[model samples]
Target: MDNQRRGFPKRCQCGEPVVLKTSTTAKNPGRLFHGCPFGRDGNWYHTFKWTDTSMVEEIEDLIEKVENIDGAAMTLQKGVNACESQIDTLAMETRVHLGVVEKEVEEMKMQLRSLKNIVGFVMVMVLFFMCMY
Candidate 1:
């Protein structure tokens, strides 16, 4: 049954159903594969792989290249997303810090104005008493 023709259904060890493709060979026989539906589980329950015959090797290489490109794309997208999030976070933090600084400056200005008013009132009081004397 291992040498069965391509496109045939084969039973997995766990009783999962899989289809053998046209890439089976003599040496590395019996590899199963499936689409993205089974990708998360780390085992392709719906398909299998075989040895590297000349024809199979060419096809395998092409498939490997395609998968590599896909993986690189995913990594790049993830990196970009991470960088964007970091930038947003920094912007928010900067805005909050600026707001705090502005509030502090306003408070200091008010205090200075109050001190000036008190000094001016004391000077006028002294001048009035001195003139009377």
Candidate 2:
């Protein structure tokens, strides 16, 4: 059973209140744990999880969370990169469109200059013919 998911034991499965105690066994001397008062040493029927083991499990869960966050971050980074690429493409397109508009403006300026010269020459010829008559 995953006792780690259950977290710190408040009550035993046997419907008895758990209390903190120290292990007196040779294998685990002075180890703190929570268990029912009715629980016996080396008994598997009762809840008797080691405190240190529970903490280790907690740390493992945190590591898994960090890994999940890292994966999410990587996914977000990919999205940002795609957005940047799209922006670059749009910028290039804009520059090309602006260049075409600028060329048209230059052409219009040259046409305006030619029209002005033709108008000035016609006005001078009209005045000279009127004076001759």
After superposition, candidate 1 runs with Cα above 4 Å error: 1-60, 126-133
Worst 10 residues of 2 by lDDT: 1-10
Which segments of model 2 are wrong by more than 4 Å?
Answer: 1-27, 33-49
Report residue 125 deviation for candidate 1 (angstroms). 3.9
- lDDT by residue for model 2 over 1-133, one digit each (tens)? 4643455677888989888899988998999988889999678778887888767777877888899999999999999999999999999999999999999999999999999999999999999999999
lDDT of 1 by residue, 1-133 (tens): 2334233335544565544344234753554433222323346543343423424655766788899999999999999999999999999999999999999999999999999999999999999999999
Whole-model lDDT values for every prediction: 0.64, 0.87
Instruction: State each model's C-alpha RMSD to the native.
Output: 11.8, 4.7
Clashes of each: 6, 0
Q: List the residue pairs that clash in candidate 1.
A: 31-48, 31-49, 32-47, 32-48, 33-47, 33-48
Clashes of 2: 0
> Quick one: best TM-score, which candidate?
2
